[model samples]
Target chain A: MRELEERIRREGRVLGTDVLKVDNFLNHQVDPKLMVALGHEFAMRFADAGVTKVLTVESSGIAPAVFTALDLDVPMVFARKRKSITLSADNYTADVYSFTKQETNHIIVDKRFIQPKDSVLIIDDFLANGQAAQGMMEIITAAGANLVGAGIVIEKTFQKGRQLLNEANVRVESLARIEDFVNGQVVFANED
Target chain B: MRELEERIRREGRVLGTDVLKVDNFLNHQVDPKLMVALGHEFAMRFADAGVTKVLTVESSGIAPAVFTALDLDVPMVFARKRKSITLSADNYTADVYSFTKQETNHIIVDKRFIQPKDSVLIIDDFLANGQAAQGMMEIITAAGANLVGAGIVIEKTFQKGRQLLNEANVRVESLARIEDFVNGQVVFANED
Candidate 1:
């Protein structure tokens, strides 16, 4: 967690008040070594939860989810944003509001992949508005799978995402929680 | 490669003429153990290529790309399908035609992540018509990066993907190459 926090402080770009760009090592371009360490940290944090699967929505979340799945030795399932012809007709879907895109899109998963009794851990790169995490939880709930908790690499604590997830009674763990960003400088929540 | 071949023969489902579904293990829902094995195989194949980065187009390709990056101990860069606020304005963009979706989509990568001197290895979940791979190649070319080769988990030999890549003079290594699907069974090409 310290390593993540340090890397975030070093490589992460604080843009304005809300946006934090970590494309160098977190999302677009992934550092596998850092990813593996983060995976271990998540596993250590959720060691007792009996997580059978790791669920995440595509593109950014896939790398961390894969590493977390490897650490947990469980299967990793990613919800596809676009419905391809190859996907099965039977699927569990939920609409996710994208704060960045300013639109809602449906994220879907094959019903066959998620069993009724599976315990799932949701992982993602960023937790801003918590819309993507909420959508994933909806799909998991629809499939009758038990939601263990959600793990995030970076979180904007000033946002209402944490409050929303907490209201849903979802336990959330983020490696680096941002308290605020002022004049291109990040203020960690724990610092104060 | 035998493990991968066995996985394909056992868990892979053939739908109609060309659609092969391995959602239980490969793309949608990933088996991390198998993915690690596949990663080792890719590392072995492209060991001498001096790959500085592993590149893949997002969604399904992320898992394999992550594992491949882990095996090679290099960073992985995934080209995003949709444009986001986090994406930089300066990018190397390529139009990819999806056979399954029946539409062409633009895949973009931040130009800064991939440098001119970087040697990249493209990894993907499946290689069908090679459109996705071609799109990735275009990005690499645009960035002035050298593409070492491509590693695919499953390749449909019946399709023109292999031939197209061959014509482009790009080396491709696939764990399981499907000769054909007969009576819902996958028949792989004989190993040379």
Candidate 2:
């Protein structure tokens, strides 16, 4: 977690009060070494949750989900934003509101992938307003699967995402939680 | 490669004549162990190329791209399907035609991540008509980067993807190359 926070401090850019750009090593361009470390941290945090699978949305969430799946020795299921022709009709879907994109899009997963007895660990790159996490939970609930918890690499604590997930009784673990951003200076939630 | 071929034969569904769905392991639902193995194989194939980065498009391509980056000990840069608030104005954009979706989408990569001197290794889940790979090549060229080759998990030999890529002088290494799918049976290309 310290390594992630340090990396964010060194490479992260603050665009506005609401946006943090970490494309250098987090989302668009991924640092696989750091990703593996983050995955190990997630596995350590949720080691006893009986996680059968790791679930995430397309694009940005795939990296962390893959690393966590490797650490937990479980399979990872990513919900596709657009349903291609190759996708089967037997799928569980939920419309997720993207705060950044300012639109709602359906994210889907095959029904056969997530069984009723499985416990899924949801992971993502950023947790802003918790819309994506909520949508993933909806997909899990639709499949009659259990939501183990949510693992986030970077979280904006000033936003209501954490509150929303907590109110829904979902345990959330974030590597770096941003308390506030004032004049391009990031204030950590728990400054060590 | 044998493991991947076996997975496709067992879990892959053949839809009509040209579609082979291996979402269970390759794309939608990813097996991290198998993905890592495929990544290792890619590393072996492109070991002499001096790959500095792993490039791919979003969604399905991110999984194998991550693993390939891990194997190559480099960073993975994935082109986003759409422009978001997080994406900057300075980017190399290319239009990709999706045969399955029957539409053209613009894939963009931030200019800051990929430099002119970087040697890139492109990875993808499938190479059907080579449209996506061609688009990625355009981005790499625009950035003045060297494309070492393409590492594909599955290639439909019956399609013109390989031939098109070869015509473009792009080296392609596919783990499983399908020669034909006759009467619900998969015929693999002769391995060297």
Best model number under DockQ: 2
The per-model DockQ list reads 0.83, 0.87
lDDT string for model 1 (A52-152, tens) is: 99999887888788888899999999998853334446998888888886877889989987789999999998888889999999989989999999999
lDDT of 2 by residue, B35-118 (tens): 889889998999899999999998888888888899899999999886332445699888888899787888999998789999
CAPRI tier of model 1: high
Q: List, residue by residue over A35-136, the lDDT tens digit for candidate 2.
A: 899989999999999999999988788898898999999999998885432445698888788778687888888898999999999999989999889989
In model 2, where do residues sit more than 4 Å from their true spots?
Answer: A83-89, B83-89
Model 1 error, position B110 (Å): 0.9
**Interface RMSD measured for model 2:** 0.7
* Model 2 Cα shift for residue B87 (angstroms): 12
How close is every model to the real structure, measured as TM-score? 0.95, 0.96
Q: Write the residue-wise lDDT of candidate 1 on B62-105 in tens digits.
A: 88888889889899999988532344568888888888978788
- For model 1 the local lDDT of residue B44 reads 88
